[model samples]
Target: MTGWTAEDMPSLTDRTVVVTGANSGLGLEGSEAFARKGATVVMACRSVERGESAAAEIRGAVPDATLDVRECDLGDLANVEAFADGLHEDYDAVDVLCNNAGVMAIPRSETADGFETQFGVNHLGHFALTGHLLDLLRAADGESRIVTQSSGAHEMGEIDFDDLQHERSYGKWDAYGQSKLANLLFAYELQRRLGNHGWDNVISVTCHPGYADTDLQFKGPREMGSTLRTAFMGIANAVFAQSAEQGALPMLYAATADDVIGGEYVGPGGLFDMRGAPEFQQSNEASRDEATAERLWAVSTDLTGVEYDFESA
Candidate 1:
């Protein structure tokens, strides 16, 4: 099916899910749905206060919800490692790992590890987190899924192997785009690696929220927008962008949907794949290029120092 709704998915009861950046926005929406579906949902956030508050809000909505909040800043490599350890300590099994938390356009900032902010938090952090938690995921009783969030902006991105940290010069949008492109590449390569290793049981997918009017843009500087762009975004959000709940549908589908294929890219089925119901969305040429995906995988492996089980494949 091209377009799918969360309601069209099978039961997710007894499943245990971990969602990074679950404090608010799409991550929180996805966590709420999973918790409401009788799954144990962990809100992995950078701020304990925000994470707990989000959990409380979810509990208020679903009084019988099974939800817990944990803190880990993905921008820090050490923190990512600790988060993986924390997940191992907290859960015996993790059925779904939603690498949902991310940053948008912002003034240049370095992660705790001194890498470019966007790449650090969006791609590298998730890379390490996933690598460290492989055992727990493999222990999950049924199909284990990982859904990585990519963006339409990836079409404009090119990975700079020479200067990934932007040591020479950097533009916010270029950095953001590269990180998002890395996301798609990671997901695609992950699926391929898993298949080669015969761990095809673990599904990995990518998706964009399709211009949902979340805090990603609103929380940034005022210069990043103007009266005109603000008004445009407002109208665009209302007309083309989906609600947070709608935006999370693809994630929820990819997480719990039966018969979902590995490496599939899902997003809104309407207009330019920007809004509507969740469906198999298209990736840009840059993201879809097989060679780039492979090279990026090698780069990621080199950077993260963790290799996927793909030798046999």
Candidate 2:
């Protein structure tokens, strides 16, 4: 297809897909689409009530939708580990694992692991979850995928090895950018490692939602107490942001597209990659730095204690 949208998504019969932050926004939209295509979606969210409600709404729309609402708080490593363990006990194999949960720019804070909130939750949390579930992903009957959600903001990011947590100084946007950049780095590095180990069945891909209008935008302004910025965001979202469904197209495409290759980055096709149909896109040079990616991987493994046994695969 020249242009890709949700309508182009292929059938997902008998597929077991896992989506983090699946209660709302891009995650919810993506989960609903997967269910519509016949995949049994596991909705991993922080709140059980919201997750059940989202699952019900999807079931209401698609009567035969197969959905499971599971609790997972990405800000806490313990919770992520427990969630992964539970998935292993219940599911035999996983067809797709979409690391779609994340936090954007907000007041300087830390996760339960004591790392900076954005870096900890956005990058490290997903890293640990993927590592924990690596066996299930590898056990799939056929090709399986790990699609990570990155951002356009990654273009401005720089990873500071000296103070990775931003305890010395913190700029919300900069911290957020670093986390997004880390997402791409992790995706690419994972694909590379998989290739090195001849694990070609598991493809690692990355995507961005562009400027999607969702509750994720409000959190930063709310935490920072920036009334003016909050008002501006409200207006900008109305005027510039794409709907959550539209924003989810890139992720959906990355997760299901037949032509998708490992280490590829997907995003909007329109101007500035803000909004449009899903298409193959480019990430910044910083995101592609091999040395930095290796260093970050080592740090992440140390921080979360979730070692990826690529050699064994």
Candidate 3:
């Protein structure tokens, strides 16, 4: 994917896709790109109003776009379950699932479900949702793909087994890093298990938008436009990031490329994978550790109470 372009992407004519956090940024742009390829897109977000607005934006761009807006608050597992159930009822099967919605570098806060906000929303919620849709994915009969959005921050993260929640102590950056790392691990392990279970028909992969200028890094009111915050964001955006449309390229490639393999990762092809053309990328050494992958999967099942037959995941 070193020099991949959307024009080179195969048509997604019959694909039905769902993208989390589709109200804006990379997710929104990704949905737009997919719709342009003739796929039916679903924008899964926390706000129906915001999602519908984004849908309107996409439809304005692609007059014949087929799109749907569904409310999904990832911080709450109850909502995830409902979202999955709603999806199952609304569509016979889904072709692609982009686990892209995420909270980044946020201060300590608890989700409605009482889990740490970043970990819950970015990792566990996706974990549960993936499990919830595993059967439908397999039923798609080799036409399905799952893309988990990760980040370069994963390189700095180590899964703290003693405290997955950072219950006793919490730092915003580290928690966010840990969550992103878990995303990679989850994708890798899912691919491996699917292979072991003889379900090679399903594909699982991970990707990250090289430093994209998105609202992912700013959420709270106080940090919205502070001078220092603005300066830092500007520096990062100018020096290392691409536009959100560019940021979503690796994921778009992973989702639509004909040759993308399960368990592989894709990212920007540039300095530190921060910006440039889309291409295959690698995560930190910890991301591929088989032992850690196994334990993390078990821990995820325990925490989310969403168990899949290990032989069929």
Candidate 4:
């Protein structure tokens, strides 16, 4: 494909998609793309007012777009569970789940569940949400997919099993890397488990935005009140980053592309995989360790009290 775009997305009529952080940035772009293609989209946000505004903007352009704004803070497991329960109650099945919301290199913090902020919201939050929605995904009439957003920073990540929450020492980038790496590990491990359990219709995949110039890029610096860092990042984003729309192509490809299969990691194909067409890419060796994956799965289940029931797989 010389140029792959959202225009290439297949008709998603009658499908229902849930995109976390759909209130802004790549999530907003992706949600709009899906809605344009005729899918009902659930914009899962941490704030209801912001979510409604985003949905209204989408409706202004696509008047018939089916959009629902739901509040679900990824850093809060209670909110995640409530959001999942409401979704299950309202919809018979979910065709796609895009775990796209995340925080960047912010200062050390903890989620409402007492886990590291980045790890809690980026990895565990989506993990628990997916577990809660497994049945709805399985109920889809045809193929169903889960796309967990990962990142290139994952190359620097090392899951400190002993200090998962960085209890002893904390570096913002270090924590962010670990969470992104965990995203890939979770996605691949979920795929393997699905295959083992013979759940051919349900697939798990992973993707990265590839330096998208979105509001998220500034979250960390803003949160830390670092004007210089924020300004530098803003300039860097202008010079080196792709638009949020372009950055979202990889996830869209992984979500609906006919050639995609379970366990694939899709990202940009341009220089350093930062800004180009979506293509299959390899994650770091650490992210591929089976033992780590297994251990993480067990730890996650215990931490979230939500387990993937592969009994019907």
Best by lDDT: 4
Off by over 4 Å in 2: none
Evaluated at residue 153, the lDDT of candidate 2 is 93
| Model 1 C-alpha lDDT per residue in residues 1-313, reported as the tens digit of each score | 5556656666678888999989898998988888878888888899999899899899999899888888789888777788788787878988999999899877788898788889989999898888887777777897899899888888888999898988798888899999999999888888877777778557788888887867776544555646776676667667766788888888888787776788889877787777787777678877877888898778777877766544421
Q: lDDT score of model 3?
A: 0.87
Q: Global lDDT for candidate 1?
A: 0.82
Model 3 alpha-carbon drift over 4 Å, by segment: 220-227, 310-313
> After TM-score superposition, what is the CA distance of residue 106 in candidate 3 from its true location, in Å?
0.5
Tens-digit per-residue lDDT, 1-313, candidate 3: 5577777778888788989999999999999999999999989999999999999999999999999999899998999999999988978778899999999877788888788898999999999999998877776735699999999999888899898899998988899889999999999999988887888778899999978988775563244446677567767777766789889899999998888899989999887788888888778899999899889999989988999774553
lDDT of each: 0.82, 0.94, 0.87, 0.94
Pairwise lDDT winner, candidates 1 and 4: 4
lDDT of 4 by residue, 93-147 (tens): 9999999999989999999999999999999999999999999999999999999
Q: Sort all candidates by TM-score, best to worst.
A: 4, 2, 3, 1
By how many angstroms RMSD does model 3 differ from the true structure? 1.8
How much is the lDDT of residue 305 in candidate 4? 98
RMSD of each: 2.6, 1.0, 1.8, 0.9
Clashes of each: 0, 0, 0, 1
Regions of candidate 4 where Cα sits further than 4 Å from its true position: none
Q: lDDT at 156 for candidate 3?
A: 82
Instruction: Write model 2 residue lDDT over 1-313, tens digit each, in one string.
Output: 3567787899999999999999999999999999999999999999989999999999998999999999999999999999999998999999999999999889999998899999999999999999999989999989999999999999988899898999999999999999999999999999999998889899999999999999899999988878998999999999999999999999999999999999999998887899999889889888999999999999999989999997664
